[model samples]
Target chain A: MQMLRKLSAGLLLLAVASFASTPAAEAAGQTLEIVKKRGHLKCGVSQGLPGFSTPDNRGNWTGIDVDFCKAVAAAIFNDADKVKFTPLSAKERFTAIQSGEVDIIARNTTWSMHRDTALGVDFPVVNYYDGQGFMVRADLGVRSARDLDGATLCTNQGTTTELNAADYFRSNGMQYEIVAFEKADESVAAYNSGRCDAYTTDHSALYAQKLKLSDPKAHIVLPEVISKEPLGPLVRQGDAAWNDLVRWTHYATVAAEEFGVTSKNISEMKSSSNPSIRRLMGQDGSFGDNLGLSKQWAVHIIRAVGNYGEIFERNVGVKTPLGIKRGVNALWTKGGLQYAPPIR
Target chain B: MQVLVLAAVLGAMAWLVGNVQSNLERQNINSGFGFLSERAGFGINQTLIAYTEDDSFGRVLAVGLLNTLLVSALGIFFATLLGFSLGVARLSRNWLISKIAMVYIEIFRNVPLLLQIMFWYFGVLRNLPSPRQAVSIGDAIFMSNRGFVVLWLEASAGAFWYGLAALGLVIGGIWLRRRAANAQITTGQATRVWRPLLGLAVALFGGAALMAGVPFALDVPHLKGFNFRGGLTVIPEFVALLLALSLYTAAFIAEIVRAGINSVSKGQREASAALGLPESVALRLVVIPQALRVIIPPLTSQYLNLTKNSSLAVAIAYPDIVSVLAGTTLSQVGQALEIIFITMMIYLSLSLLTSWAMNRYNQRMAFVGNNT
Candidate 1:
């Protein structure tokens, strides 16, 4: 009896050891397979940034970035609700994705050259065009980002914003002391206390923060686009096929917008003679076979989150309280920077 | 069985750490404390110690260590004062006072400290009026949205003179106490010790003033346009963190103190009373001295706990070691293996040092009580 129990215990321990060792034993091959077998895509997202990944009263998350993750779910499983949202702080998002705690990270992360090459992660597409800017109290009498010389700037730590703010100030031959915090809320409080002379972040975030402030009329974001912050989503490096699927989910949205297919109008536009739209919607043939998806993969994404422009306008763009106009985020046909490659 | 158990645990830990290291290194990630010598080149928000973006990472870690020690040390001092007072009051005869003390402990002990910290920070501290409309304690003091500001004396060389005089007074007090004790023992007459203590205090204070008064000047805080100009600024985040930590830890300390005081035999107070001692003297000269032996060991552990708990300062952005080293530096460098290892080692060393001091304290008290 004792021998049998001991044998079973030894077998259990070996199984556990093998489970733990599998990550490195076959990391590249098993990682992609494990994610597919799990069915639900685990995606890390921002903590309650209204236009990014904020949750509603019922704890159901909805935002532009949240929709991006949902669209990835739609493409993968033909189900929009198959994404599990992991709420992460600014510091934890990238690490969480890298450690395989999340299958992908759909947080409003910026795509930089250093991040592309050094971070060991793949940024799929520049879904949102953003720029670094500063917001200051109108009562402070400071006019532009240049006037922020010698000012104390409250920026969120663990971000490109910190380095960008520094470069912006330094390259402009101006000097400013940085007062960074991990959370956006803490930075807002410090800025609101007049402890800071300016608050710097992506320009859209400035508008969101101002709307939440006690005095909305009291602050104005300066008119300086300092750095090129091409905001996008990312996944862990390796698995070229998985990377393609995640990247093109974002591309599908932009492509749909360019093809004049809004979510409300997509089901009706299905019968059109446009060859590009037919190919994109998988209507012309089984175009998604090589990539391993339903023929209507692009249609599923559009139905899930609408087109790129619709998601933007609903969240942080002109229709929202932030009232930010799409300057560079507009479609390519409309003389903006958003241009996607051919679906076929 | 024990040998097998120990071997298995050790082997597992070694494998886990090795796995993490190999995985990190395989990604072309260089892993070592060698990064400490590299340029930090990143700015911090709320650093007390000297730091610059141009400083080395080792210098930045030192800054974090200093901030952690400062907050924890300050919390220990304040918590002791609050705890001891509440402990005594709970034992008081007055119902109202004891009830109030009981309420204080119960309220603080039950509520989550993080929530309390947030409440104090956002609800109370954030509502403080702007600097120009600051409340003044006196002409020399101001309180506002930023924090309290008091008139500080900028001592010239006289500060050194004052420090020397104060040291002399402490030595003088010791000598006087010894003399008084000798007179009581040998001559069977009590010599007073208060007058000499007073004389030493005044002489030291006066000499420091008359000597070189360390180039003293007070830069009293002034309410400027939208901010305070002149006096030292203590931000609300730090104040809230300290307040929440001290109050939360004090509730636990008060319970420890009460348990210690109750553990002392009633016979101690009875014996002192039979010798015609007054209540205050009986408690202070007899009960307190005995109860302290029971009190200190647990109280030392509470102090250590408070120190560890202060790492939660990351939630409030206080720039403690956890926030700066573990959160910011680890994320920026992505050297989790090295960063977390260094952090754990620092905390372990701190804890071991604390336990060593507590053990020495226990030994001294054991000798003093049992031998008598």
Candidate 2:
């Protein structure tokens, strides 16, 4: 009986110990604190989307999205390289963030009502504004999307592009068939191999994917924008501090652009008399400290990834293979929608 | 002591469930089956049922389930047919025939099913001519990279009566066969049943067709804008997925069949021969029934594997349950936990149904008690 009591006591202790660990596991949702403890930020990115997030031969990732994650890493660790990227598909991206498999999702995910309200993740800011469009072979003679009646379209499954095409065709009273593949490259290859009459996706993505086709010059993107796809970074919900940190990381780049602060001249401009510049450069009030970071958070972000304009130009601008233009993604000062609040 | 273990297990389950609930609540994520009624604002390329973008998520699940069932049922049918043939050929007297069967079994069974699916979809089907230059069979059927387009029969309202008439013919045939067997048992006089039944069936079907004014109209496919319209299209994804699934499962089924045939006692075959039966009749009457006892349980497992592997349809965009419901709908609704749980339940139900059917067949084939 004494030995039985000892055994029961041991079992009880084990149960109690497991119960005690639940709260610690619950606190794992505090993403910023966990990142600080782990020393490296886990950023979810695309499998391989050019001009967004694509790794090179040596596994070095480069894109506007990649730069955004680097900026976040710099803010937290003060080192741009302290980031581990988890490549995810469209179907897997939300689950990865919701399950806490990644600290942030820097993949090119569209911000939508259903996702914002229903998904367990929060889209803090729009990094790139994209729109759905169609690309058809040059020989098809289909000038407008309206002429695509009775056509077969290829696109990636589990994306807004599929729904957008369906809605666009249905509302226009035009009958069309969609052949969606799980991977973006499969859809592009299908379109290239003449399995589909056209390929539809984000306009910017169409340009990037066209380069991978057998004859890149043979396809033309239709001059039609179907849906508003404000692609942005996402973080798990229930952590307002982490949400603010990610939101401000994006705004910091835009504000730096508005203040005419490039990575090359940011250090020299620190001595400027401009009040906005002084506040943004961390020469004024403790803005970063309020978010539990050093006062020079914005400085680290800008120095690591440059302003938004520089990141865009270096990765997907006019000189790049994608050659995307900053139409609505430009700063509000230049007649665009990108506007940032005052740092102070 | 057993009660204590059971209580501990139940308590652990309760804790896990509570943990998930609290976590989801904390994140403000909606968790329930309510999202199933919401609109599924997406289009599936291939659907066995009438589906549109305006359909609810519930309808999408139905469409996906039907597609999965279609592929799995057809895959099983073809795999069984090919597997039995190859198993027999493997035991052929001719050396080249047996070697050919061996080669086929080795080549297909050793390679991954996913690679085979990709090979058929990308390497073979995609290389077919474009729709503009599609190979046409008198214009009623076309083969192209897009898919195989065939002229199909469009049934009018009268087709229902014709279908009922066919069902009646089947029932009549079964009754006639049973009566013939009874006659042979009681009076020792054989009765010819099939010829009369065949004649009656033809007459009944013809009369029904005449009364229903021939209910089927030929729907021919023609090149419209970019695709063939007004006909049945066998999309390449389905064809590729079906081919890969059948060929891969057929290889394993062939081995199962071979082992079953070998397990039948040599004495059974010799006894049927001593009764002056032909080799084919002896094999079918004496050997097969006994071999089936060994073949069934493993064959059931192979069927389950084939059904589960159909989930790989997503890789080739076949619009099966995993692709349509779990991939697109879950992503759109952002209800991962609920959607995944539902999908798991669906697969479990399908597997259980398959196992139950196979067990019924096995019971019917088993020998009647100790008489053996």
Candidate 3:
């Protein structure tokens, strides 16, 4: 009996070793397939950026970036709620996506050339157009960013804002000290507590974080927008189908809005005669097929999160506490920069 | 059978690495050290060496290394001083001093180091009055939310000669100490070395200052338009990091120190007392040397802990190595594997070097054969 048990234990060890030696190449090109097999989409998001991705007391995530991931889930599973959110920090977001800890990263990550070519990830579309800006206390007599000479600024570490703030200050011949914190709220707390003369970030985030101050009305964002920050959702490289699916999910929402298709009226508007709307709604084309998604992908997405305008208005529009206007994020028809190509 | 098992483990590891390498190549993420030379476009808040946004990543890494070393060395020095005092105080006969030291160790060591860091940074330092309302320390130091600004001495060309004079005085002090010890050993008479040492310091430094025309001029920080204009500035983040690291590490070191001192047998002290040596001399000569043997190995570990814990400076944005280089550079270059590997290796080597030095010291303190 002892001999038999030893032989069985040796066989079990050999089996475990064989399983461990399986190569990673087989897992490289099938993010979509794996996510499908896993029965849900794993979405990477910020830990808590108020208007972008914040969790409620009930632990339900609600934000524009959260809406984007929900839309992607609806496109895949026809159930917007069939997605889990992994709250990642600025330092861990890219690695989370790279390691396949999450299938897609819908964090408000800026689309930069260096990240695109270097990080082995592809940013599908620019969901929000933002620029770096500064906010100072009204009592500081600092009217513009140029008046920010010798200012100590507080910002989150491991972000583009740090480099942008450095560049803007150096070029403008201002000597500034930046006190960076690991989390966004920590930096804001430092700024709110008077540890710094000013706080800087993407202009939209500045507005979102300003509301968190003790006296929100006491700080004014500076006028100068330093760098172009085109924030978007991204996926790992080497998966073209997965990349295309994410890209088209963003485009579908924009196209639905341009065609005057709201989630409330999407079912009723299905009978409309505009062929562009028809193709976008997946009414009469192989568009979703080409992207390897079901034909009703656009309908599911629009139904889940409404059009792009709806998501923006609900989370961060002028009516909301964030009060961010869709200046450059509006549709091209409305003289904004958001323009998507025809589905056909 | 053992060799076969080891071979199997190594073979499995090799296969896994080969698989990962192939996957990384397929995914087009470049893996190498060549990218270390690329321009690091980020700026660090505190730099010991000259660094700009235009400097290469390698230089930034160098700056980070210097910062890490500065904080660690400073932390080790301060922690040791503070720990030794607390340890001695813990054994004090006075009820108040001993209890106070006990309370201090319990409070600092029991609470998380990270929380203490945040409390010092966000709760204490950040809430200080603004720069314009900075609190003054006499006329040489200023404290505010902006930073700790102190009057710095600007040495002119003649200051180099003064530095030489100071060096000579230090050498003279050491020589006088050795001579006094030799005299006591030979003549069985204790010589008072303090007077000569103090006189030599005062005369040498005073003469150097007069000859060099009072070379150092104090540059006090003055209020500028929005902030302080020009003294040596210690940013609040750095202050908080230093304060938190030293205090927290000191608590652990105190416990180690108390244990070490307690490890010296009571018989030794009693024997020294019987030999008619003073209590102070018994502690300084007989007790401490023996206690240090027990103290140093664990004390070395504490020093290493403080160095490693310095990485938490990232939480408060002090721009230590883990913060500036590993955090920012890894994100920018997209060389997570390479950057993380290199960072781990750097820390590994740092700990190894520290252990090696401490071990050498330990060996020196160790009792020789038949000495015990």
Q: What TM value does the first chain of each candidate achieve? A: 0.92, 0.93, 0.93
Per-residue alpha-carbon lDDT of candidate 1 for residues A27-108, written as tens digits (9 for 90 to 100): 4734446756888888899887788888889999988889998988888777889988999877787667666788888788
Score residue B202 of candidate 2 by CA lDDT.
88
Which window of ten consecutive residues has the lowest lDDT sum in model 3 chain B?
B363-372
**Candidate 2 residue spans exceeding 4 A from truth:** A1-29, B187-190, B368-372
In order, what lDDT does every prediction score?
0.80, 0.89, 0.87
Candidate 3 accuracy as TM-score: 0.94
DockQ of each: 0.35, 0.56, 0.52
Give one digit per residue, the lDDT tens place, for model 1 in B123-210. 7886776666778887777777566777777666657887888899999999999999998999999889999899889988888778
Error of 3 at B279 (Å): 1.6
The order of the candidates by TM-score, greatest first, is 2, 3, 1
Per-residue accuracy of model 3 over A194-268 as CA lDDT, tens digit each = 888899999989999998899999999998899999999998888888888898899999999998999999998
TM-score of 1: 0.88
Query: Considering lDDT, where higher is better, how would the candidates rank from best to worst?
Result: 2, 3, 1
Winning model by lDDT: 2
Going through the candidates in order, what is chain B's TM-score? Answer: 0.89, 0.96, 0.90
After superposition, the stretches of candidate 3 with alpha carbons farther than 4 Å from their true spots are A1-27, B1-18, B194-212, B368-372
Whole-structure CA lDDT of model 3 = 0.87
Of all true interface contacts, what fraction is found in model 3?
A: 0.56
